[model samples]
Target: MQHDEFIIQVSNRAPLSSRDHAELATRATLETLAEPLAGGEPFNASAQLPRGIAEYLRHQYAESGERFSLDEFFGRISQREGVELPDAVHHARVVIEVLSEAISSGEINDICSQLPSGLEPLFEASSQGQIRVNT
Candidate 1:
């Protein structure tokens, strides 16, 4: 999807008040998601995302993943997005749902493969939809 469409989806789905809010949520979630993905995985995922938004994933990559739990993942997103934990989690779910829609199924499947099982809930079919990472 194009960047504007991606942000619009995130904004509408999260029911956020503004485009800026949606952008922040997307950035936070993508950056945090990048933290746990080892090697060039984040770069691989970013390859399919829109240009500027993809940097959120690209900037977070390391030679190896910095292991953390699902809760910790949410914690980081909460901090980054400057929202409360519950909002962060919900926004994250929405961003992930959009991400799945933006990228190919094969790409998303590769992403899911890298995450721990606990984080799997983010990808599970939801009433809202599926997993997303970046714009």
Candidate 2:
């Protein structure tokens, strides 16, 4: 699939629009860090990429009732991608920290805060759709 299409697939699966963006950003960052994770790489001993994310979020909601620690969130993702997750995890954490500080300092809601609205929704829709139908 093309990059845009891949992003769309990612969106559909995300539980919330914001979470989808974070997830996609993390994936893109990971892909850029090394090589894009090979398709169909076994994420862990059993789970695939989508499954890992779903499990992570499910645990998050079950435990904290809110997302915490981009490091933890994306760390699980990197593992699922079958890569050493720390580089991506650190990068993602930096981005989050910067964004959090910016939001505290200013009024940026979106992480990038410049992209078109509904873009994240599209991603969540596309990603979740693909996972349920294809995977």
Candidate 3:
């Protein structure tokens, strides 16, 4: 995702930020995942996540030295069965999940390659779930 596309995907879901911060956040999260592709390991499990979707999360982690946090927004929504998330996070999760699936399928470069073309459609299709970005 030539960095810019990753930033765009994040801004599509969250508040926009300066380009530098966006890039830093993207690199941080990707770096967190770039090693030892053993999926079942703890770091691997946590690293598989996409934390760069929200500028706030990135800024928070950068300034406060905390990694991505689900507790702040969703508060463990994925843990409790039948509990629903707020529309925004839900939609963001959809986008992230799709990206994750593509990554897992060894299509990271393929998906990233079609970034400009594929991104909007992926975001739009993810909107079909019970979620809305409101922006």
- Weakest 10 consecutive residues, lDDT, candidate 1? 126-135
Top candidate (TM-score): 1
Please, what is the whole-model Cα lDDT of each candidate in the order they appear? 0.82, 0.33, 0.35
lDDT of each residue in 41-98, candidate 2, tens digit only = 2122113124433233222123222333434445555665444675445434433332
> How many clashing pairs per prediction, in order?
5, 14, 0
lDDT of 1 by residue, 54-127 (tens): 88888835324777788898999999999999999899988888888888878777777888767766676545
Report the lDDT of model 3 for residue 34. Answer: 28
Root-mean-square deviation of each candidate, in angstroms?
3.4, 16.1, 12.0
Listed in order, each prediction's TM-score against the native is 0.88, 0.25, 0.31
lDDT of 3 by residue, 14-94 (tens): 443555544433443333222212222323223444444333223322222223333332333232212345533443453
Candidate 1 has a TM-score of 0.88
What lDDT score is found at residue 115 in candidate 2? Answer: 20
The whole-model C-alpha lDDT of candidate 2 against the native structure comes to 0.33
